[model samples]
Target: MGVGGIGIWQLLIILLIVVMLFGTKKLRNLGSDLGGALKGFKNAVKDDDSAKNDSTDENQPSENTDESSSETVDITAEKVAEKAEEE
Candidate 1:
């Protein structure tokens, strides 16, 4: 038995029929298109994961905070507001 009870000869015959219906060139083109689509999907997923990591990094407290000052500058908006009021 071949794949799920179908013999090897039967499989070959089916393959021949498929090749006859859709020539070799069309089959090659379809295979390449499918491969390209899969590659693109993989890249998109990787980019999405990296983007998520970047967003999380932005939300967390920065490690580069100035240790010399006791008061921590949480947001840059406060400094901007102060400067605007001074001006």
Candidate 2:
């Protein structure tokens, strides 16, 4: 009357055997390591998604390109003026 046809007592006995084979400390360490690995994998997936979004945004044309190009021109002019002043 437990999980599937295996009774609660049978499950408990298997759990006990496993615990006896591997001490409590080892089991705790293994559980934490598995949790850490899952957390790291989640973070990596998030970063990859954000990178893909950024690349797609750059690939598409936007209204800001003209403004950005003008800004670049102004910066170049300023640098040229500074060099002329230095000379």
lDDT tens digits, residue span 1-87, model 1: 999999999999999999999999999999999999999999999999999999999899877877676576667888889899999
* lDDT (Cα) of model 1: 0.94
lDDT of 1 at 24: 100
- Residues 8-83 of candidate 2 have per-residue lDDT tens digits of 9999999999999998999999999999999999999999999999999989977656665665357888899999
Q: Candidate 1, 61: how far from true, in Å?
A: 1.1
lDDT of 1 at 31: 100
| Each prediction's TM-score versus the true structure | 0.68, 0.68
Q: How far is candidate 2 from the true structure (C-alpha RMSD, Å)?
A: 11.1
Model 1's C-alpha root-mean-square deviation from the true structure amounts to 8.8
Looking at model 2, the pairs that clash are none
